[model samples]
Target: MSAPTPSARVTLAELAAEAGVSLSTISKVLNGRTDVSRTTRAKVEVLLDEHGYQRRGTRTPKSRLLELVFHELESAWALEIIRGVENVASENGLSVVLTESGTRHAPGPEWVEGVIARQPAGVVLVFADLPQDCRRQLESRSIPFAIIDPAGDPAPDVPSVGSANWAGGMMATRHLIDLGHTRIAAITGPADVMCSLARIDGYRTALNAAGLPFDRQLIRYGNFHVDGGRDNALELLRQPNRPTAIFAGSDIQALGVLDAARQLGISVPGDLSIVGYDDLQVARWSSPALTTVHQPLIEMAEEAARMVLMLREGEEPNNLRLDLATSLVVRQSTGPAPDAVRPLAAVG
Candidate 1:
């Protein structure tokens, strides 16, 4: 029945003075910089513990940092998500280091490893397709992480937060159907991505519900980029049985579809109706205006950041499969399917 002795408080300068090193050296050592000698590092470490001094306002063990890995920063989608993440992280007094995976081809493994080695309090994966090697490294280290718009086969242990892409797809298709279009085609992202597959499934689901046959020819694959959409749309238009309406998976692709339609001299909503997903800012500014399925990008990002913070604190997130709803925005680009017209000369 004895009270424990209060530990003495020590500052960085005090530690440096005792260890016979400069304040900068002490700061570098504490921050895990590699410039300090082993003897100096050891001496500083012993004093830090002896004084029971904790670094001001950070997670235990003095590293109050997190890592956020994104697929592409150039995209408005990613930028919105990052804004959400930054807001949450800042509110929580956590420092977040962001890195982009670049285009699908340039996933820098070294950068991921460096982040992992830094031993962040947690990690937020913003729409990046995690490789097996990276997944393995994260798992082995028991790092707390959450995937936003998870593309790979995520382990059950790690949670993910994203909009229900399949539902978004179904909603988009249904909107076209409600507008009196039956011959609807779909331009989708890479087959490897789970979101793309889910979207395809949703499209099929809507078609099946309406008793419409699922035509394989109507489905085209793209890289979720404008050029890919343009190429695929050109092929779709070339077919003898062209669709009256098209549902593009992303806003960027939808822009390409519009370009292709223009090149083919087809009038939007007159010859072809178009709808796109992601409801990005460009959708509003597009020439005929774009009807799109709106995903709550900012909310999704905020939720993912909150999830990472919770995981870092060893808290189980309540909603494992957070399926945010999607809304269909109506615009001038979509209308009733074009009607078959007889030649004026023949009629006369």
Candidate 2:
């Protein structure tokens, strides 16, 4: 917001003060985001000449900001991740800037380029990916990054934090098997997602361990969101031999599965037991309460923040990826499989 100062260095806050504009307006101008009004943009441009506000790609020693980007912020679990990052950041006198990339967890090259230009102390990416070129750009600029629960496979050298997804998946399936569920199904996230595949492997391993034949038809690959769960559940439940138990990849999807069962008048626990991953808050609010895997998402977020901070201090973590513990949290949603059920046509 401040006037032009080609040779001077002024913080964004100072520029905003001089231009009498909000910090966001100044940022939009700085990032060339194009959402700002022409009138405000013109005013800000005029002030840019007086104050040297364009930090550009300069790695300022005084910059205490950390950029946190999410692919999508609509999930209930997102709040928990935010709180964890904020807690660590606040204690270390670091501020956080939040960015949301469209529907995917990782933004495109354009967004990555903007972040590189911002030159924050470090960046934390959640449920997203960084292209090799983008990763190189950040490294070339001495910017370190950490990914949490990465939605895709990360480079071998990329720092990341997540849970034991395969083990968690195995645990969920084992529980249903222990309840005497021979006909079981698992609705997992996208097949390409690393975590999703790991979870599917866990499920398959558990079934094999129990001496149960692995039926590929019992597996459904879909999005990790709620609607995907419901639609996938409908397909499975309408089949001639629907599963007596179901394992949902996420709490959000599990909730959708619950809805599908209700729509079909299938009494949960009594007729169809359910299990879900991610012990998000909504799991506790489900009609029968969700039996879920505790993925330790908050802890993962906290570890990611710490890792990025350490990187900024020129510290290399001992490991490329940090994995916290994951365990099952049994609740009312899961029970012993029922002895019999009406035909799929009757429910349909």
Best by TM-score: 2
107-174 in candidate 1: lDDT tens per residue?
A: 47656547645877778886444554455445434466777773444545557777878888899999
Candidate 1 lDDT (Cα, whole model)?
0.77
List model 2 lDDT by residue over 1-348, tens digit each.
Answer: 233544556677877888899999987765556688878866876655444333455456787888888877886668888888888889889898888874464566556757755768888888555665456556545678899873466766789888898899899999999999999999999888888999889999999999999999989999888898899998888887889999999999999899899888888988899998989988998889999999898888899999998887778898978889899999999998888867754654
**TM-score per candidate:** 0.75, 0.79
Q: Tell me the lDDT of model 1 at 166.
A: 83
Each candidate's lDDT (Cα)? Answer: 0.77, 0.82
Which segments of candidate 2 are over 4 A away from where they belong?
A: 1-59, 102-105, 108-110, 113-117, 344-348
Task: Give the Cα-based TM-score of candidate 2 against the true structure.
Answer: 0.79
- The CA-based lDDT of model 2 is what? 0.82
